[model samples]
Target: MTKRRGERPPVPEALPAPVVDAHTHLDACGARTPEQVREVVDRAVEAGVDRVITVADDLDAARWAAEAATWDDRVFAAVALHPTRTSTFGEVEQAELARLAGQPRVVAIGETGLDYYWDYAPRSAQHEAFRWHIDLAKRVGKPLMIHDRDAHDDILAVLDAEGAPDTVVFHCFSGDLPFARACVERGFVLSFAGTTTFRNARALREAARWVPEDHVLVETDAPFLTPHPYRGRPNEPYCANYTLRDMATLRETDLGELATKITRNAERVFGLRDAAKS
Candidate 1:
């Protein structure tokens, strides 16, 4: 098959309760300007995805994320040099990220961790950057949102070695049951993206089911990982409903109840209690 392609999927029905996109890339999703960001967020709100944590993958993205958070009360930010871009990490980038980390709306230091899947950056450079981001998260007293791809073992090793922040989230959690258990034991939150809805992602579904309600979160990882039935389509924050609904089905929980629970989890992890209330 040539495979289907098109614009972002249509927004699903509003969730029974509001939830958060724990990790996403607004800039990459083409929401670069304030108006564009609001347009996207407005649609997300219509789908009951009331808030989001827009994450950065590089220095420029870090800047954009920080500013984007300020663009809307519903949007917060996570700043970091992604694993693939860690090769360019240096004093200048470090200082900028540090500055952005302290911004009022920047809630976490991340989308950072090991990614052995893409060899864009050497393992050594990724390791160094990951450790630095871990420390940065600690210094800022914010959660660390990790992006662990095919480097689960090393990601865990680094977290152990550097000691983790009080709050850590494995964004787009791709781990199987064992790894999920390990993360749960360590009290690290696992944010599931649309991939969990894939029919072939049986292990991921099992892991999601095994996760304690308190440790589970839902995200779209927007502009990527659109949920099943729309797997090849472009993703957006509004599509978070699809993933969360699928998650509810997989976990055998009430959709509204699960939405409320994940919303609480995101609030706790991102320190968004005030935002959640508003």
Candidate 2:
């Protein structure tokens, strides 16, 4: 079913336990202000999605994400220059990102990595920025959240070459079973987004089932992949419940049990010790 513009799907029944949206872009979802962020997060909470890591795609977005985290305890930030925007990466942007990455609210250095599907930046420039972000994640001792598109091979190769961070997550993972196995073998966490619920994403569903409970994660990637039945609509964290429920069905596990597992996995990867406090 296609979603109408400016329309949002109804919130699904809340899960037995809260689940974290491993990655989302609150700012892109039009939650640019503190009040707007709270509104969105509140709705998410009601749907059993209590925490989210809002990721930035550029310098301006990075600034907004870091600031947004301070507005609500349920929100955390991941700052980086997205692979598509790497064409503009330089000393000034890098320095600013480094500053944001050090903030207490900034828990990850990511939404970085390769996106070969878009030629917004040259391959060389994207590679350079990916290496830099990888190093930054390592230096900050934070997990690296990747945005791999059609460039899976290069994404893995670069991470291997740079010696990946202590923890790495493939945000909105779109790979097949073999690729999923490769990532899991390297100890990388795979975050399944709304796309996993789509009927056309058979391979992705297979990969989701293949992943171990500890290595699996869930996200909305909101305002983008809005999950099945609500595909093409504007998405928000609250909609994560749909994806979580679908994942549980795919794994043949109890929804509540899976929610608990995904939440625990998120806490571990993002080092969110105070997650429950929020």
Candidate 3:
């Protein structure tokens, strides 16, 4: 991993506590039951993360994510049909998503957007499904959490034309400085994940540096992009500290300031009003 300026190298024991993991799939992280969720969450909480957003990318997973969120105050939900799951969605899928959105626990409408990496679904279907997710967010009065892969132009065009929720976030943002600037201009939030810590992610680092303090957010996208030093192992919410620290260093800011800003950004973008009450 490219070491962030002043990063004290990867020593898990030396990291700070009480960070926020803005995006993840608790269920997909190999945790299938409530007890399992608690185990993972316990580890994260012990590691100092205050909350974790568990994103569901499919109908069943959405329900599971919502249940997990409802069961634990530390967890929040993002519900939608992922780009690859578009084929499974139609009238039934849409109705299910809308139903799930009605639940207070489901704060956002995504983990949606385009993904050209695998092209698991047809491009046309991906666009159509993506539009549905965008409209769902608008209708539900929640911010949108997008997942774009090698489809920046298309994603931007769709968001520009379709209009987004009051708050829009590029989850695990994968774009260069120009895209970051454009998103900032449109008042969108850029969330960096472990990819930002990759040794080759100079473009992402530049974007991180340019993003406004309030507009920057960090996440682990865990069970996936495990940050360096733990890159080969399975990632979890606690690993987000690496991302938070990396973002702080990349933006040339204090870790405390960056952590606070990102925590607030997560709350703002997700429409989370009651961290404790919920």
Candidate 4:
């Protein structure tokens, strides 16, 4: 099918088994209103993506993500200020995030690590904000979602200094095998995005191929990283199946089995089923 309006790529075919998009941005995917969010999630469901965890990148997004999760049973939320937006992290922002993080629908405290790629926030501010988020995650007993961009060493260092959370997920994991091994050894989950499908992301592919089933999860990180063949196009939760297929091929495993394992990993890390029961 041709690209949709806004150059959105067509949703990929459904996987054999249901899968969860462990990370994505419903707001960035052009789904803000409750109806829009539900529409977007429904599209993903049609593609066999059973659930999605919409991630927040700032204070406003944190609020939106929290409420958006309540909009649909299939939608969950992760709240945190993006490292690039840490320049303004203060008492007010922290308080709001803490409140939002406590929401029943909020599953993780994340997308909060360091991002050396963007000079938007100074290193000092990023470090301070990152530490605060780490502490919050620890207190809340939720997984810490990291957004490591060209700051792998520092990211790991900060997590160590702050005492890493019980469940730490490297969102859009942009690390090589060595770093991946280090995270795995520490019992951190690596959530792969569309980048794993990029032909040039051999190092990332290696990490994805080798990460044990129990420690792995999949995400879209969309309306960005649209996966191979659709790279540069707008992305949404539905596109996760494409990345799953690629990873299955890369790992030389059955597509359905890999899908099941990844979904289960997501469930365990985010306590999805438990949250629903409560």
Candidate 5:
């Protein structure tokens, strides 16, 4: 419909700009609608975070993640059925997930892996689904975004058996020093999230130190795990600063240097440079 002559023209608001949000869940975090995503992205860009990789754990959420990338220049996506959703995977599901993998905005193949802590699904199912995702990642030539929760040993075993991708990342890394050392030695990227900012998360701090500079990345995992100073509140990409600052302190480096290194690491692991222009 054409606008009426007497109607005021729409005024364009300046973009807040963007930074690199390694991982998040815009759809699950109440950024369900495009407008909500736009508002959050605006705040994030204003805070110097331009791009965010929105991840999803199920088919519906996966579609939303992909749609989010379509809605804004600041958003990208990762699709997979999380470990807890192992029961949801089936022949049809795998076919659909593979179809989503072909989407241009879908950059990685995960948030998938083992999680013994919750055990929402059987161990065998989780293991099988994990292998499926790894195979899909390899077939699609995309990086694997892993989620290991109290199941690091099993996760590593399977990844090794399945021949993990050349570009693999352990998102929201909360492992002990030994695990961190092993991951770094294997050339796997470890992404530090808001959990890294907790004062009492000493183990994570130690693990942060163990991750090599080039193998380290940062994320918000927003609407959850809000970092310190904003703890007990909702998380957002804008709050990534707290975790980044904590990481800088952990590595005894300047914040800018840490950010630059993490950004580079994200690009290398996720093949962000190969994505279509936002």
Candidate 6:
């Protein structure tokens, strides 16, 4: 694991057009209070990442995420008990998540797919929690944000079995081209993270290149997958510009054009109305 060491990468030049850090963790990024949230967001805005969706990984995070969304118009929220944290899942947890998922600014039910890598929670518990989140997304009329790690097959199987929500976003998409194709065929959206910019992530880069514009989005997944050249350093929403630039180069498209498409896609999927301007 890359320990948090060294300085964070300097903010890259602002995007030609604004984009959203489709997935991030404001709490992990040290933005708990309203003022802290605003500071983080202002940095992102300067880098042309105008909005962010701060995703929750547990009950406390879910509450903070919901409250954080209320602090700034550009900040949104996705509430769910992360799959690894589902070992104690129960009725009270379900009711609270259901309630948080309904908040107007809580736009998705997510960061809640399967993770075979950590095996932190029993597979059964993860599966059960994933299914519940899927159902919650459907009920709330919001998108489902997934965190798939070495469980692509099982993730697909569960989504298939449960009947996925109308809108689904694979946050920090880690699959290869074939998996990307499958997800695209299912009308699911892939939110690429800084991982795509790594030198060893050739397959991920290929998937990024092949995925259709409308079926893709960008994120920082900050405080974790900081873009290449800055790997192992703390990340913030502003770092999304680095990932966007990397994707644009690989896709052979203009940065602004890709930014526009991704911005539009985030707005459309999140049901935002001029979010950057609002």
| TM-scores for every candidate against the unseen true structure | 0.97, 0.97, 0.92, 0.97, 0.91, 0.96
Using TM-score, give the best candidate's number. 2
Per-residue C-alpha lDDT of model 3 across residues 1-278, encoded as one tens digit per residue? 33353332333542453666889989878888878988888878766677888998888899998888977788888899889878656898899899988788788888899988986799899999999888888887888899999999999899889886788889999899999999999999888898888878899888887888888778888788888665556788878888777877877888876777777777777767753465
Model 5, runs deviating above 4 Å: 1-19
What is candidate 6's lDDT per residue for 1-278, written digit by digit as tens? 34556677788789999999999999999988899999999999999999999999999999999989888998999999998998999999999999988888888898899988896899999999999999999988999999999999999999999999999999999999999999999999999999999989999999999999999899999888999878889999999999999999999999999999998999999987733343
Tens-place lDDT per residue, model 2, 97-203, is 99999987799998999999999999999999999999999898999999999999999999989999999999999999999999999999999999999999999
RMSD of each: 1.7, 1.4, 3.8, 1.7, 8.0, 1.9
The C-alpha lDDT values of all candidates are 0.90, 0.92, 0.81, 0.91, 0.81, 0.92
Candidate 5: residue 269 Cα off by (Å): 1.9
If both were scored by lDDT, which would come out higher, candidate 2 or candidate 4?
2
Per-residue alpha-carbon lDDT of model 5 for 96-170, expressed as tens digits? 899998888899998999989896899899999999999999999998999999988888889889998888889
C-alpha displacement of 132 in model 2, angstroms? 0.4
lDDT of 1 by residue, 60-162 (tens): 9999898888778889999999999988789999999999998878989988999988899999999999999999999989999999999889989999998
Mind giving the per-residue lDDT tens digits that candidate 4 earns over 174-276?
A: 9999999999999999999999999998898999999999999999998988888788878999999999999999999999999998888988999999777
Runs of candidate 4 with Cα error greater than 4 angstroms are 1-6
Q: Which structure is stronger by TM-score: 2 or 6?
A: 2
Task: Name the regions of candidate 1 deviating beyond 4 angstroms.
Answer: 1-4, 274-278
Number of clashes in every candidate structure? 0, 0, 1, 0, 4, 0
Model 5 vs. true fold: TM:
0.91
Candidates 4 and 5, the one with greater lDDT: 4
